[model samples]
Target chain A: MYDLRELTEAVRTFNRDRDWEQFHDAKSLLLALVGEVGEVAELLQWQPAATVREDVKAGRLHTRLAEELADVLLYLVMLADETGVDLGPAAAVKLAATAQRYPASKFRGQAPERQ
Target chain B: MYDLRELTEAVRTFNRDRDWEQFHDAKSLLLALVGEVGEVAELLQWQPAATVREDVKAGRLHTRLAEELADVLLYLVMLADETGVDLGPAAAVKLAATAQRYPASKFRGQAPERQ
Candidate 1:
C-alpha cells in the first residue's frame, strides 16, 4: 500500500490537514531535504554497512522515509509543478537524450567510474 | 567548462573510445552507479564533517562525482532516451507535478523531518 501512488495520496492528506501549501517554497523544501538526509545519516551513525542496508530493507532506518521521500518528492513535484514539467513523462524525456549520448556501444560493461 | 554539458560530452568521448555498449546492460549501469556512490563514500570514510563539506564545495569528495553523476545521468538518459522522452523537457514535467502537491502552504517552517 505504501507504493508511490499511495504515498502521494498521503502527501495530499498531509498537505490538506496542515494547510502547509504556502511554506514548501523551493529553498525551504531543499533545506528540509538536507535535514531528512541528515536523519538518514543519523540512522547510520556508527553502524556498520550490514546494519544500514538491513535498515533499508527492514524499513527501520527512515522510519520517516515515507514522509521524507514524500518531502523529496514534494520538492521534485514542486519543481516540476512550478516549471510545468510532467513528473512521470520527464523521466522518459531525459532517457531519450541519454540514448544519444551513451549510444549503447560506449556504456556497456564499463565499471561505474570508468564509464 | 566542466558543467553538465561538458561532462556529457566527456561521456560521449569515453563511449567512442571503449565501444562498451553490449555490457552496460541496465543491471551493469546500476551496479556501476552503486560503485560510484561507494567511491564517494570512500572519500568520506572516517573523515570529519568539515572535510566532507570541503570536498563538496572544493570539488574533492567525488572528484568522480561529475563522472558518477554522468553515469547516473546515463542511466536516466537511457531510460528517458529509450521511452521516447526528452531529458530536458522531462525535468520540466516533473516540476509541474510538484507544484500541486506542495502548494507552498503545507511545507514551510517545518524542520527536515516534521514536514
Candidate 2:
C-alpha cells in the first residue's frame, strides 16, 4: 500500500518544482478540492443507485471516477499539509469519535434520521 | 504515521458492526461525501484567504474543519471500497500521470489557463 506521506511528498515536490506553491494558498487549494469533488459528484449524479457499483466496476465509470477521486485526494493532502494537519492521525481520531457517538449497538441497522 | 489500510479496516469494521453496509451503496456514499465537502466549503466560505492558516491553527476553525474533512475521507473510503477501487494505489498512479502531463521544466511558474 502506498503511504500518505509518499503522496504528500510527491505533491510537495510537484508544486516546488513547478514553482506553484505561491498559487496554492489555503483558499485556492480548498477551491480546487471542491472543484474536483464537483467533478466526482457530477459523474455519479444521474446514474441509477443500484447500477453504480456495476457501472464503476465494468470500466464504464472506473477510469474517470478514479481520476477525479485521485484529484480529490491530492488536493486534500495539499490542503492538510498547508494547514499543518496530519490526515492519517486526524482521520483515526475522527473515526474513533464517530464510533463512540454512533455505537454499533445503538445504530445497528438504523439509519440516522437525517440520512 | 498512520496507515491508509488501517483507516480502511476501521471503516470496514465500523460499518460491518453497525450493519450500515446496506445503507452505503456507491451513490449514497458519493452524495454523503459531497455533503461533507460542502460543509468544509461552507466553513471556509466567508473567511479571508489570508488568514485561513491562522484560523485553522488557532482552534477557531480547526476542530470543525478537521471533523468535516474526516467525514469526507471516510465517505470517500466507503465509496471506493464499494466500487473495488484501492485509493492509495490509484492516487499514486494518478499523481505519476499528472507529473508527466505537466513536467516542471516546461510548466514552471506557468499557471494553467483554467486555474
Candidate 3:
C-alpha cells in the first residue's frame, strides 16, 4: 500500500533536515548503493545454492539480508530522488520493455529452474 | 508517483503469466536479487570514486548501470512481494533508524565528500 513517492520524499526530507543532501549526489548515491549491494552478495559468495536455502529456512536471512536490502533500498530511493528518476514508473516502463525483449513464451522454464 | 504495490503486482503478473513462478520462490528470488546486485557492484569494482563520477558524467553509465539497476529493482519488487515485505515502509523505517544511527552532523563532511 505504500507509495514510492512517499518513501522518496521521506528520505529527501530526512536528508534536507540534516543538510546531508550535500553528500548524496547521483554518483555518491550510486556508489553507496553498489557498496550495500556488494555486502549482500558477499554474504552468499561461494555458498552452494542448497546452503543458501538452508540459511533462509533456518531464519538466518532475516537479519543480514534484510539490513543489506534495506540499505540498498534506502540508497536507491535517495539516488532516484536526486537524479530525478521515478523508480516505480521507470521500472514499470522497463518491465514492459523487458517483457517485449524476453517474451515469456520463449523464456519460460529457463534459468533459475532450481538448477 | 507510482505505487510500490503496482510495481510489485506488475512483476507478479509478469511471472504468473509466463508461469515463471515455479522458479521464483522466496529463496530463489533472494538469490536472484543478490545476483543482480553483484552485477551492479562489479561495474564499479576497484575503480576510484573519481572514475565513477567520470563514468557517470561521460555518459557511460546510461545503459549498463541503468539496466543492472532496473534488474535489481525488478528483483527487489518481486522478492518483497513473495515475502510479504512492504519495501517502501520497510525502507522508510530503516532510513529513520539509519538517520539516528549515523547523525548527519557527526557523519557529514565525513564520507563521500568528493575526496
Report the poorest 10 consecutive residues by lDDT, candidate 1 chain A: A78-87
CA lDDT, every prediction?
0.41, 0.84, 0.69
Top candidate, metric DockQ: 2
Over the stretch A3-114, how does candidate 1's per-residue lDDT look in tens digits?
A: 2233345455555455665565433443453454354345345655334334443444333433333333444344233223343433334444555755556556554345
Tens-digit lDDT string for candidate 1 (B29-104): 3345345335434434565543433444344433343333333334433322222233343333433455565555
Best by TM-score: 2
Tell me each candidate's TM-score: 0.41, 0.94, 0.74
Interface RMSD of 3: 3.4
DockQ of 2: 0.72
> How well does candidate 1 match the true structure in TM-score terms?
0.41
Better of 1 and 2 by DockQ: 2
**Under CAPRI classification, how is model 3 graded?**
acceptable
True contacts kept of each: 0.05, 0.65, 0.34
> Which regions in candidate 3 have their CA more than 4 angstroms from the true location?
A46-48, A51-54, A57-60, A112-115, B25-68, B82-84, B104-115
TM-score of candidate 2 relative to the true fold:
0.94
Worst 10 residues of 3 chain B by lDDT: B106-115
RMSD of 2: 1.6
- Give stretches of model 1 more than 4 Å off: A1-13, A44-55, A62-71, A111-115, B1-115
lDDT of 2 by residue, A1-115 (tens): 3588877898899899999998887888888998998898888888898888888888758888888888898899898888877788788888898889898889999986664
* Number of the predicted model whose lDDT against the real structure is largest: 2
